[model samples]
Target: MSKLAVGLMSGTSLDGIDAALVSIDEDKKMTLIDFETLPIDHEMKAKLKDAMDIGASSNELLCSLNFELGYLFSQAVKLVCEKSHTKLSQLDFIASHGQTIFHIPDGKFKSTMQLGEPAVIAYETGVPVVSNFRSMDMAAGGQGAPLVPYFDYVNYLSDETICLLNIGGISNVTIIPKNASIDDLVAFDTGPGNMIINGLMEAFYDLPYDKDGQIAALGQVNLELLEELLSDEYIHRSPPKSTGREKYGGFFVEDLIKKSKLPKEDLIATLTKFTALAIVCNIKAFGVSKIIANGGGVYNKTLMKYISESFDGQVEIGEYPDAKEAMAFALLGYETLHKRTSNVPSATGARKHVIQGSITYPS
Candidate 1:
């Protein structure tokens, strides 16, 4: 029998929710039936950004935002179903990658948190919901990130070295050897993806993002500044480690800006160059043969060209279609629902393959 699933993704960029309506056959093949990005309101966006940064959000605020995000996720799912002419009754389940508030991977907390009450989704949609996927991996001694590699293995693996690169708020790459399962994969955060560039654009240009990286393309790169940006110790860290805004975020960029005496345009340009260089340098370090790029970053022509040129013929972009992450997340959710083990133990450093996600049944 075929199963219909709704997958929700709110990336680290704080851009919006990507809703994908997917259908999977008994054979484990996936088809993306419909997809849309639901924009978050400006007020809520500000609140989320604030909370994402290090601060004490009132317990009331945290509780309220949790349910509110859950409701919004449900609304996105409903709109996707309505627009696609699919029925809630037809859905097998909803898989939600909720808004990640804090990813405390080491030191004190040793926990990662993504919040969108699956119970709320289940209550509203009358379908089972599976969510909070990362914590499970972390519990088993893994990075609890780059969760899409299992999906990449299932759908994009070929008889060659393939690097599935996701350029979300934080960039990460998954190296898949020919016919490799999760065991043979190597994955880690490459560096800043779209998040740093987007944050800079918003702070200086009053734009949500640099459209096609036009502003960046107009500026000149200061090679020295670019080198300084790339010298961070995180880039030298070994695999099995992941990063987010907490590391390359607003404050990090602000400090970079404060330390640099270059022109504003030049600064932006250098930062964009920094992002691209980080990817290229990591590719060299990771020994990835061909990189398949996706996410909002791929839409930026300048960024794409920089990466393409950096690697020369060593890598190519977009081996798969757009919406790859959403498609893969849908697959992840499906695997989770069936009680199948989904995480890549080597990529995440999990002790064993764990059937990830908490299931919430409809009332």
Candidate 2:
């Protein structure tokens, strides 16, 4: 039997809430039924940014954003259903990645917080909700991130080694070697994806992003700046890792803005190379045969150019770039509903593989 489900994802980019309606067969095969991204307004993004600054916002404000985002997530759910002429009653479950406000994956009191209350989603949609996907892994002494590896492994397991790279707010890669089992998976964050680049773009040109890498094409990459950035320890850090806005947020870019004297375009170009190099540096050790790229960064020609240059012809974009994460969450939700473990122990450095996500049911 094939069951219908919805996956909701709101990335660090503060771009929007992505909703994917997916159908999962009894055999665990998935088909994306309909997908949509409902843009978050600037006001909401500003509030999210404020809340992200740990302890900056009042507890009440943080609580409000959670419910507000849940409402927005539910709206996205409803939008996708309407697009596909489906009904809320027809959904088996809704899996939400929620909005990651703060994450401290290492240290004595390791913690991660993804807002957008699942209870609100259940209340509004009258459906089962699977959320807090990272907690269980964290409890098992894992970083509780880069959870997409399970999705990559199930979908693209192949005879030859291949890398599935997603460049969203943060960039990450999942490598599945030849004839791999779940234990053979290798994945980690490759440092900044579009975060630093997009932050610079928004700060300089008042644009959300440099569309198609047009601005960067006109400028030169400052080698000095690139080299200075290459020294970032996180990018070169070994696997069983993950990162987010805490390391590459607006403040990170603001510090750069205060220090750099290069022209805006040149700085953007240099940072784009930095993003590409970070990814390349991390993946080179694996010797994968191919890289299947996805997420928002795939549309940036200059970023792609740098990545493609190193891999030669080994780089290619995956299907439905924007929808992949949401689709993955839908599958994760499916697995959780079936009491299956979806987090890869190797990828997360978990003490053991555990079925992730907390389930919420409608009253």
Give the per-residue lDDT digits (tens) of candidate 2, residues 1-363.
899999999998899999999999998899988999999998998899899876477798888889999899999999999999998999999999999999998999779999989999999999999999999999999999889999999899989889999999999999899889999998889999999888988898889999999988889999998999999989878888999999999789999999999999999999999999899888887778899998999999999999988674389999979999999998888889889999998898898989999999999
Which pairs of residues have clashing backbones in candidate 2? none
lDDT of each: 0.83, 0.92
* TM-score of candidate 1 relative to the true fold: 0.96
> Over 4 Å off in model 1, which ranges?
314-322
Per-residue alpha-carbon lDDT of candidate 1 for residues 1-363, written as tens digits (9 for 90 to 100) = 888998889988888888889889988898788988888878888888777766746667778889999999999899899999998999999899899887876664468878778889999999998888888888887778879888878877888787777888888888888777668888888888988888888878888888898988898999887777788888877778788978888888788767878777888888888888888787675456788888888878788878888884455566443467766777888888788989998887778888888888998
Minimum summed lDDT over a 10-residue window in model 2 is located at: 306-315
What's the lDDT for residue 115 in model 1?
A: 77
Worst 10 residues of 1 by lDDT: 312-321
TM-score of each: 0.96, 0.98
